[model samples]
Target: MYRANEPIDGGQNQNAATVPGVVARPRAIRDHLTPILDDLNPGIVAPEIQAAHFELKPVMFNMLNSIGQFGGSPHEDARQHIHAFLEVCDSFRQQGAHEDVLKLKLFPYSLRD
Candidate 1:
């Protein structure tokens, strides 16, 4: 099931050679995704919702994050990208939920940033 309480690691490449915070970490991404999953779960269920959402959350988040990056500019684009991404993700997520309910399968999400 899509539990809202799973510990989020942000999917950082743990094996990468890095000192620490210097790396472009996924902390923000994780933070962003947690609430999304929590918000989404009122409508989804799987034997492994926690694992599945964990696997898919970043993809959707990153995609939305990218759109904002493009829409915003030297002035400030993150907001644009984030907004676009979330809009798209929210629509797709609802669709995926409906599909999952019908097929009894997991919804696959992708982040193309």
Candidate 2:
């Protein structure tokens, strides 16, 4: 389960390899995922979220599960969906698993930069 309330400070246990403040924006971790986080209702894989939205992770969906609108919620944003899909593709590529990016949604180029 997603331990959102846990004090995310495992590095200070005195037996860890790294120290505090080494990770750089620990709360901004985009892929902080865990299985069976029951409170999230319909939790999703962390990688499904886009890196750009990492800072807004906590309040992004207002505590809803299944991404911003994967289940057809009214809060759906096309831009967010596109970004999430692209991020997933990037993650797959980083893992040496390539996916053919034939043609995806069209958005303003500036949004990427």
Candidate 3:
């Protein structure tokens, strides 16, 4: 058990030594992390990438509905229905449709009530 102010080894505080040409400064956590954080998360995306992303359009609901619907009927072959749906999705993808937008927006329209 050692006292807080008492020197630990040979009457010297081993942790209190200062290095040559080095100055200790008080700083916030944000200050130390700002450079790393900035590198990891640049706030703004490049304009060309943004433009390319914005240009991708999802297939319209009406178009997807017109293509086909799967009602989960016992007579319906699930594999065939899934294959057909994926085929259509693939065609749309080839035409620059965003995959997420197509799946989220158009998939529901291909479901029969």
- TM-scores of the models, in the order given: 0.23, 0.23, 0.39
Q: Compared with the true structure, what per-residue lDDT tens digits does model 2 show for residues 1-73?
A: 2243333464454443444544433443445654546666544222342333222233323322333334335
Pick by lDDT: 1 or 2, better one: 1
How high is the CA lDDT of each candidate model?
0.42, 0.37, 0.58
- Residue 77: error of model 2 in Å? 0.9
Instruction: State the local distance difference test value for candidate 2.
Output: 0.37
Clashing residue pairs, candidate 2? none
Q: Better model by TM-score, 2 or 3? A: 3
Clashing pairs in 3: none
lDDT of 2 at 54: 26
lDDT of 1 by residue, 1-113 (tens): 22233323443445544443344433566686665454455554543333233334455555544454342246665565445544665554432244334223212321222
Specify the poorest-scoring 10-residue window by lDDT in model 1. 102-111
Name the regions of candidate 2 deviating beyond 4 angstroms.
1-69, 94-98, 101-113
After aligning candidate 1 to the native by TM-score, how far in Å is the CA of 31 from where it should be? 30
1 against 3, candidate with superior TM-score? 3
